[model samples]
Target: MVGAIILWIIMIAFLFFILHAVIQSALDSSNMAKNIQDIRDYLYDTKREGRTDKRAVAEQLLSTQPGAPQDLYEECPACGEKIIQHEPECPSCGLRLKD
Candidate 1:
Protein backbone atom coordinates (compact mmCIF):
# COMPACT_ATOMS: atom_id res chain seq x y z
CA MET A 1 0.00 0.00 0.00
CA VAL A 2 2.81 2.43 0.90
CA GLY A 3 4.61 1.67 -2.37
CA ALA A 4 1.47 2.36 -4.37
CA ILE A 5 1.02 5.72 -2.65
CA ILE A 6 4.64 6.67 -3.39
CA LEU A 7 4.23 5.79 -7.03
CA TRP A 8 1.12 7.95 -7.31
CA ILE A 9 2.96 10.89 -5.67
CA ILE A 10 5.84 10.63 -8.09
CA MET A 11 3.51 10.50 -11.05
CA ILE A 12 1.64 13.59 -9.85
CA ALA A 13 4.89 15.48 -9.37
CA PHE A 14 6.03 14.62 -12.85
CA LEU A 15 2.76 15.76 -14.34
CA PHE A 16 2.95 19.04 -12.42
CA PHE A 17 6.45 19.66 -13.70
CA ILE A 18 5.39 19.08 -17.28
CA LEU A 19 2.40 21.38 -16.84
CA HIS A 20 4.61 24.12 -15.43
CA ALA A 21 7.03 23.87 -18.33
CA VAL A 22 4.24 23.98 -20.89
CA ILE A 23 2.71 27.06 -19.24
CA GLN A 24 6.03 28.85 -19.15
CA SER A 25 6.69 28.08 -22.77
CA ALA A 26 3.27 29.35 -23.80
CA LEU A 27 3.79 32.61 -21.90
CA ASP A 28 7.16 33.12 -23.54
CA SER A 29 5.68 32.56 -26.97
CA SER A 30 2.89 35.06 -26.31
CA ASN A 31 5.35 37.68 -25.16
CA MET A 32 7.51 37.17 -28.22
CA ALA A 33 4.53 37.50 -30.52
CA LYS A 34 3.52 40.74 -28.86
CA ASN A 35 7.01 42.16 -29.23
CA ILE A 36 7.09 41.25 -32.91
CA GLN A 37 3.74 42.90 -33.47
CA ASP A 38 4.94 46.05 -31.76
CA ILE A 39 7.97 46.20 -34.03
CA ARG A 40 5.79 45.72 -37.07
CA ASP A 41 3.51 48.53 -35.96
CA TYR A 42 6.46 50.85 -35.46
CA LEU A 43 7.85 50.04 -38.88
CA TYR A 44 4.48 50.61 -40.52
CA ASP A 45 4.14 53.97 -38.81
CA THR A 46 7.64 55.01 -39.83
CA LYS A 47 6.98 54.09 -43.44
CA ARG A 48 3.64 55.86 -43.44
CA GLU A 49 5.36 59.02 -42.25
CA GLY A 50 7.70 59.00 -45.28
CA ARG A 51 10.84 58.55 -43.17
CA THR A 52 12.63 56.10 -45.41
CA ASP A 53 16.30 56.89 -44.88
CA LYS A 54 18.09 54.26 -42.85
CA ARG A 55 20.20 56.80 -41.00
CA ALA A 56 17.19 59.00 -40.32
CA VAL A 57 15.22 56.10 -38.88
CA ALA A 58 18.11 55.08 -36.69
CA GLU A 59 18.71 58.61 -35.48
CA GLN A 60 15.06 59.05 -34.69
CA LEU A 61 14.85 55.80 -32.74
CA LEU A 62 18.21 56.05 -30.99
CA SER A 63 19.52 59.02 -29.07
CA THR A 64 22.79 59.52 -27.28
CA GLN A 65 22.64 60.21 -23.60
CA PRO A 66 23.64 63.60 -22.30
CA GLY A 67 27.44 64.13 -22.18
CA ALA A 68 27.98 61.17 -24.50
CA PRO A 69 30.31 61.44 -27.47
CA GLN A 70 28.55 62.05 -30.75
CA ASP A 71 29.21 60.18 -33.97
CA LEU A 72 30.67 62.19 -36.84
CA TYR A 73 29.10 62.42 -40.27
CA GLU A 74 30.42 63.73 -43.56
CA GLU A 75 29.02 64.26 -47.02
CA CYS A 76 29.90 61.64 -49.60
CA PRO A 77 31.55 63.27 -52.60
CA ALA A 78 30.13 60.74 -55.03
CA CYS A 79 26.48 61.08 -54.10
CA GLY A 80 26.42 64.03 -51.70
CA GLU A 81 24.71 61.84 -49.11
CA LYS A 82 25.68 62.36 -45.50
CA ILE A 83 27.42 59.27 -44.19
CA ILE A 84 29.07 58.30 -40.97
CA GLN A 85 32.73 59.16 -40.79
CA HIS A 86 35.29 56.33 -41.14
CA GLU A 87 32.85 54.18 -43.12
CA PRO A 88 34.70 52.37 -45.90
CA GLU A 89 32.07 52.87 -48.60
CA CYS A 90 29.29 55.28 -49.35
CA PRO A 91 25.96 53.65 -48.67
CA SER A 92 24.17 55.67 -51.32
CA CYS A 93 26.60 55.47 -54.24
CA GLY A 94 28.77 52.51 -53.09
CA LEU A 95 31.91 54.57 -53.65
CA ARG A 96 34.98 53.21 -51.90
CA LEU A 97 36.28 55.91 -49.64
CA LYS A 98 39.35 54.25 -48.18
CA ASP A 99 41.61 51.24 -48.48
Candidate 2:
Protein backbone atom coordinates (compact mmCIF):
# COMPACT_ATOMS: atom_id res chain seq x y z
CA MET A 1 0.00 0.00 0.00
CA VAL A 2 1.03 3.62 -0.54
CA GLY A 3 0.75 4.37 3.18
CA ALA A 4 3.17 1.61 4.09
CA ILE A 5 5.57 2.74 1.38
CA ILE A 6 5.46 6.33 2.68
CA LEU A 7 6.14 5.15 6.24
CA TRP A 8 9.10 3.11 5.09
CA ILE A 9 10.49 6.07 3.19
CA ILE A 10 10.14 8.30 6.25
CA MET A 11 11.91 5.76 8.44
CA ILE A 12 14.68 5.43 5.90
CA ALA A 13 15.10 9.19 5.75
CA PHE A 14 15.28 9.45 9.54
CA LEU A 15 17.90 6.75 9.68
CA PHE A 16 19.92 8.53 7.01
CA PHE A 17 19.86 11.77 8.98
CA ILE A 18 21.06 10.01 12.10
CA LEU A 19 23.83 8.30 10.21
CA HIS A 20 24.90 11.60 8.63
CA ALA A 21 25.05 13.31 12.01
CA VAL A 22 27.11 10.52 13.53
CA ILE A 23 29.56 10.56 10.65
CA GLN A 24 29.94 14.33 10.86
CA SER A 25 30.66 14.17 14.58
CA ALA A 26 33.26 11.48 14.03
CA LEU A 27 35.00 13.57 11.39
CA ASP A 28 35.02 16.64 13.61
CA SER A 29 36.50 14.69 16.50
CA SER A 30 39.17 13.24 14.24
CA ASN A 31 40.16 16.67 13.01
CA MET A 32 40.33 18.03 16.54
CA ALA A 33 42.53 15.14 17.70
CA LYS A 34 44.84 15.62 14.75
CA ASN A 35 45.12 19.32 15.48
CA ILE A 36 45.91 18.72 19.15
CA GLN A 37 48.59 16.19 18.24
CA ASP A 38 50.12 18.58 15.74
CA ILE A 39 50.27 21.35 18.31
CA ARG A 40 51.85 19.04 20.87
CA ASP A 41 54.51 17.98 18.39
CA TYR A 42 55.25 21.56 17.42
CA LEU A 43 55.56 22.61 21.04
CA TYR A 44 57.91 19.76 21.83
CA ASP A 45 60.10 20.59 18.86
CA THR A 46 60.21 24.23 19.84
CA LYS A 47 61.19 23.37 23.38
CA ARG A 48 63.92 21.00 22.20
CA GLU A 49 65.32 23.79 20.02
CA GLY A 50 65.82 25.90 23.18
CA ARG A 51 63.02 28.28 22.31
CA THR A 52 61.51 28.91 25.70
CA ASP A 53 59.64 32.06 24.81
CA LYS A 54 56.62 30.12 23.69
CA ARG A 55 53.98 32.63 24.62
CA ALA A 56 53.30 33.27 20.97
CA VAL A 57 52.81 29.59 20.27
CA ALA A 58 50.61 29.27 23.31
CA GLU A 59 48.58 32.21 22.20
CA GLN A 60 48.18 30.66 18.80
CA LEU A 61 47.13 27.39 20.36
CA LEU A 62 44.61 29.06 22.64
CA SER A 63 43.15 31.29 19.99
CA THR A 64 39.35 30.91 19.95
CA GLN A 65 39.35 31.39 16.20
CA PRO A 66 41.01 28.01 16.19
CA GLY A 67 38.24 26.68 18.53
CA ALA A 68 40.43 26.56 21.68
CA PRO A 69 40.30 28.28 25.02
CA GLN A 70 41.98 31.65 25.55
CA ASP A 71 44.61 32.40 28.20
CA LEU A 72 44.71 28.73 29.24
CA TYR A 73 48.00 26.90 29.74
CA GLU A 74 49.54 23.87 31.42
CA GLU A 75 52.56 25.71 32.82
CA CYS A 76 55.19 23.65 34.58
CA PRO A 77 56.19 24.95 37.98
CA ALA A 78 59.63 23.38 37.72
CA CYS A 79 60.87 24.32 34.26
CA GLY A 80 58.14 26.81 33.29
CA GLU A 81 57.29 24.87 30.19
CA LYS A 82 53.98 25.96 28.69
CA ILE A 83 51.86 23.05 27.64
CA ILE A 84 48.32 22.53 26.46
CA GLN A 85 45.37 22.91 28.81
CA HIS A 86 44.08 19.36 28.92
CA GLU A 87 47.26 18.00 30.50
CA PRO A 88 46.62 17.55 34.22
CA GLU A 89 50.32 17.67 35.11
CA CYS A 90 53.59 18.79 33.61
CA PRO A 91 54.67 16.41 30.90
CA SER A 92 58.33 17.05 31.66
CA CYS A 93 58.11 15.91 35.29
CA GLY A 94 54.93 14.74 36.95
CA LEU A 95 54.63 18.02 38.78
CA ARG A 96 51.12 19.22 39.44
CA LEU A 97 50.75 22.76 38.19
CA LYS A 98 47.27 23.41 39.55
CA ASP A 99 45.80 22.87 42.96
Candidate 3:
Protein backbone atom coordinates (compact mmCIF):
# COMPACT_ATOMS: atom_id res chain seq x y z
CA MET A 1 0.00 0.00 0.00
CA VAL A 2 2.76 2.52 0.88
CA GLY A 3 4.76 1.43 -2.18
CA ALA A 4 1.75 2.09 -4.44
CA ILE A 5 1.34 5.61 -3.09
CA ILE A 6 5.04 6.38 -3.64
CA LEU A 7 4.80 5.14 -7.24
CA TRP A 8 1.87 7.45 -7.97
CA ILE A 9 3.72 10.44 -6.51
CA ILE A 10 6.76 9.72 -8.68
CA MET A 11 4.58 9.45 -11.78
CA ILE A 12 2.94 12.78 -11.07
CA ALA A 13 6.27 14.50 -10.69
CA PHE A 14 7.49 13.04 -14.00
CA LEU A 15 4.35 14.26 -15.77
CA PHE A 16 4.86 17.74 -14.40
CA PHE A 17 8.43 17.79 -15.69
CA ILE A 18 7.25 16.80 -19.17
CA LEU A 19 4.60 19.51 -19.13
CA HIS A 20 7.17 22.17 -18.20
CA ALA A 21 9.48 21.12 -21.04
CA VAL A 22 6.64 21.36 -23.60
CA ILE A 23 5.66 24.84 -22.46
CA GLN A 24 9.26 26.13 -22.68
CA SER A 25 9.70 24.71 -26.18
CA ALA A 26 6.54 26.40 -27.37
CA LEU A 27 7.55 29.79 -25.99
CA ASP A 28 10.99 29.56 -27.68
CA SER A 29 9.40 28.79 -31.06
CA SER A 30 7.03 31.75 -30.73
CA ASN A 31 9.92 34.13 -30.00
CA MET A 32 11.92 32.85 -32.99
CA ALA A 33 8.94 33.33 -35.31
CA LYS A 34 8.43 36.90 -34.16
CA ASN A 35 12.12 37.71 -34.74
CA ILE A 36 12.00 36.30 -38.26
CA GLN A 37 8.88 38.35 -39.06
CA ASP A 38 10.59 41.50 -37.83
CA ILE A 39 13.60 40.87 -40.10
CA ARG A 40 11.31 40.29 -43.07
CA ASP A 41 9.47 43.51 -42.41
CA TYR A 42 12.73 45.42 -42.21
CA LEU A 43 13.96 43.94 -45.50
CA TYR A 44 10.67 44.77 -47.21
CA ASP A 45 10.82 48.36 -46.06
CA THR A 46 14.42 48.77 -47.18
CA LYS A 47 13.68 47.24 -50.59
CA ARG A 48 10.65 49.48 -51.11
CA GLU A 49 12.90 52.43 -50.41
CA GLY A 50 15.32 51.25 -53.20
CA ARG A 51 18.03 49.81 -50.92
CA THR A 52 18.42 46.42 -52.63
CA ASP A 53 21.89 45.27 -51.61
CA LYS A 54 21.66 42.21 -49.38
CA ARG A 55 25.09 42.91 -47.88
CA ALA A 56 23.90 46.39 -46.93
CA VAL A 57 20.84 44.91 -45.25
CA ALA A 58 22.96 42.43 -43.30
CA GLU A 59 25.36 45.11 -42.21
CA GLN A 60 22.56 47.38 -41.11
CA LEU A 61 21.06 44.59 -39.04
CA LEU A 62 24.40 43.76 -37.41
CA SER A 63 25.29 47.35 -36.61
CA THR A 64 23.64 48.62 -33.43
CA GLN A 65 26.04 51.35 -32.35
CA PRO A 66 24.83 54.91 -32.02
CA GLY A 67 25.95 57.61 -34.44
CA ALA A 68 28.96 59.85 -33.85
CA PRO A 69 28.77 63.24 -32.23
CA GLN A 70 26.87 66.03 -34.01
CA ASP A 71 30.01 68.13 -34.30
CA LEU A 72 31.62 65.27 -36.28
CA TYR A 73 28.96 65.39 -39.01
CA GLU A 74 30.10 65.57 -42.60
CA GLU A 75 28.47 66.05 -46.01
CA CYS A 76 27.24 62.94 -47.80
CA PRO A 77 29.04 62.82 -51.16
CA ALA A 78 26.08 61.37 -53.08
CA CYS A 79 23.26 63.55 -51.73
CA GLY A 80 25.06 66.47 -50.10
CA GLU A 81 23.15 65.77 -46.88
CA LYS A 82 24.91 66.25 -43.55
CA ILE A 83 25.63 62.87 -41.95
CA ILE A 84 27.76 61.59 -39.12
CA GLN A 85 31.17 60.24 -40.13
CA HIS A 86 30.47 56.81 -38.62
CA GLU A 87 27.26 56.24 -40.63
CA PRO A 88 27.41 53.26 -42.99
CA GLU A 89 24.97 54.76 -45.50
CA CYS A 90 23.69 58.17 -46.42
CA PRO A 91 20.24 58.62 -44.87
CA SER A 92 18.87 60.91 -47.58
CA CYS A 93 20.14 59.11 -50.72
CA GLY A 94 20.67 55.47 -49.62
CA LEU A 95 24.25 55.67 -50.81
CA ARG A 96 26.83 53.37 -49.21
CA LEU A 97 29.40 55.60 -47.57
CA LYS A 98 31.60 53.25 -45.59
CA ASP A 99 33.60 50.29 -46.87
Candidate 4:
Protein backbone atom coordinates (compact mmCIF):
# COMPACT_ATOMS: atom_id res chain seq x y z
CA MET A 1 0.00 0.00 0.00
CA VAL A 2 2.80 2.45 0.86
CA GLY A 3 4.55 1.74 -2.49
CA ALA A 4 1.32 2.43 -4.40
CA ILE A 5 0.92 5.79 -2.62
CA ILE A 6 4.50 6.78 -3.44
CA LEU A 7 4.00 5.88 -7.12
CA TRP A 8 0.81 7.97 -7.30
CA ILE A 9 2.54 10.94 -5.69
CA ILE A 10 5.43 10.76 -8.20
CA MET A 11 3.04 10.58 -11.12
CA ILE A 12 1.06 13.57 -9.85
CA ALA A 13 4.24 15.62 -9.36
CA PHE A 14 5.44 14.85 -12.91
CA LEU A 15 2.04 15.81 -14.35
CA PHE A 16 2.04 19.08 -12.43
CA PHE A 17 5.50 19.94 -13.77
CA ILE A 18 4.43 19.26 -17.35
CA LEU A 19 1.21 21.25 -16.91
CA HIS A 20 3.09 24.32 -15.65
CA ALA A 21 5.59 24.09 -18.50
CA VAL A 22 2.83 23.98 -21.12
CA ILE A 23 1.05 26.94 -19.55
CA GLN A 24 4.25 28.97 -19.55
CA SER A 25 4.89 28.10 -23.19
CA ALA A 26 1.39 29.17 -24.16
CA LEU A 27 1.82 32.53 -22.46
CA ASP A 28 5.16 33.05 -24.21
CA SER A 29 3.64 32.27 -27.60
CA SER A 30 0.82 34.74 -26.99
CA ASN A 31 3.29 37.48 -26.10
CA MET A 32 5.37 36.76 -29.22
CA ALA A 33 2.30 36.98 -31.44
CA LYS A 34 1.33 40.30 -29.92
CA ASN A 35 4.84 41.66 -30.46
CA ILE A 36 4.87 40.59 -34.12
CA GLN A 37 1.47 42.19 -34.69
CA ASP A 38 2.67 45.44 -33.17
CA ILE A 39 5.68 45.48 -35.46
CA ARG A 40 3.50 44.80 -38.52
CA ASP A 41 1.21 47.66 -37.59
CA TYR A 42 4.14 50.03 -37.13
CA LEU A 43 5.63 49.13 -40.49
CA TYR A 44 2.27 49.45 -42.19
CA ASP A 45 1.75 52.91 -40.74
CA THR A 46 5.22 53.96 -41.87
CA LYS A 47 4.49 52.78 -45.41
CA ARG A 48 1.09 54.47 -45.42
CA GLU A 49 2.75 57.74 -44.53
CA GLY A 50 4.84 57.47 -47.77
CA ARG A 51 8.10 57.29 -45.89
CA THR A 52 10.55 54.84 -47.51
CA ASP A 53 13.64 56.31 -45.96
CA LYS A 54 14.24 54.67 -42.60
CA ARG A 55 17.01 57.08 -41.63
CA ALA A 56 14.83 60.13 -42.22
CA VAL A 57 12.03 58.58 -40.18
CA ALA A 58 14.42 57.83 -37.31
CA GLU A 59 15.89 61.33 -37.43
CA GLN A 60 12.47 62.89 -37.44
CA LEU A 61 11.30 60.79 -34.52
CA LEU A 62 14.42 61.49 -32.45
CA SER A 63 14.17 64.82 -30.67
CA THR A 64 17.50 66.45 -29.96
CA GLN A 65 18.30 67.12 -26.33
CA PRO A 66 18.03 70.71 -25.06
CA GLY A 67 21.78 71.26 -24.80
CA ALA A 68 22.85 69.37 -27.95
CA PRO A 69 24.93 71.00 -30.66
CA GLN A 70 23.19 72.08 -33.87
CA ASP A 71 25.92 70.87 -36.26
CA LEU A 72 25.34 67.19 -35.73
CA TYR A 73 23.73 66.82 -39.16
CA GLU A 74 24.10 68.37 -42.56
CA GLU A 75 22.17 68.40 -45.83
CA CYS A 76 23.38 66.45 -48.83
CA PRO A 77 24.43 68.90 -51.50
CA ALA A 78 23.05 66.83 -54.39
CA CYS A 79 19.60 65.99 -52.98
CA GLY A 80 19.21 68.31 -49.98
CA GLU A 81 18.54 65.30 -47.74
CA LYS A 82 19.73 65.23 -44.18
CA ILE A 83 22.95 63.26 -43.49
CA ILE A 84 24.78 62.59 -40.30
CA GLN A 85 27.90 64.74 -39.89
CA HIS A 86 30.33 61.81 -39.93
CA GLU A 87 28.81 59.91 -42.85
CA PRO A 88 31.17 59.64 -45.82
CA GLU A 89 28.40 59.48 -48.40
CA CYS A 90 24.78 60.55 -48.80
CA PRO A 91 22.45 57.54 -48.83
CA SER A 92 19.71 59.23 -50.84
CA CYS A 93 21.72 61.10 -53.49
CA GLY A 94 24.86 58.86 -53.49
CA LEU A 95 26.99 61.99 -53.33
CA ARG A 96 30.50 61.59 -51.98
CA LEU A 97 31.13 63.68 -48.87
CA LYS A 98 34.41 65.67 -48.90
CA ASP A 99 34.61 66.35 -45.15
Best by TM-score: 1
Give each model's whole-structure lDDT.
0.77, 0.74, 0.77, 0.75
Where does candidate 4 stray beyond 4 Å?
32-99
Greater TM-score among 1 and 4 belongs to 1
Model 3: residues >4 Å from true position, as ranges? 1-29, 64-99
Which candidate, 1 or 4, would have the higher lDDT against the true structure?
1
lDDT of 2 by residue, 1-99 (tens): 999999999999999999999998897689677786778887888788887754566565567246555557656768888776756677667787667
**In candidate 2, how many Å is residue 26 off?**
0.6
lDDT of 3 by residue, 1-99 (tens): 999999999999999999999998897689666676777888889988998875566566555324523365689988899776678998788999889
Per-residue lDDT value at 40 in model 4: 71
Q: Using lDDT as the measure, which candidate wins? A: 1
TM-score of each: 0.35, 0.33, 0.33, 0.33
Steric clash pairs (candidate 1): none
Residue 62 Cα positional deviation in candidate 4, in Å, after optimal superposition: 18
Candidate 4 Cα RMSD (Å): 8.3
Superposition error at 12 for model 4 (Å): 0.2
Worst 10 residues of 3 by lDDT: 61-70
Ranking by lDDT: 1, 3, 4, 2
Q: lDDT tens string, model 4, 1-99? A: 999999999999999999999998887689666665666776688899988986665454333233446666889889999888767898887898975
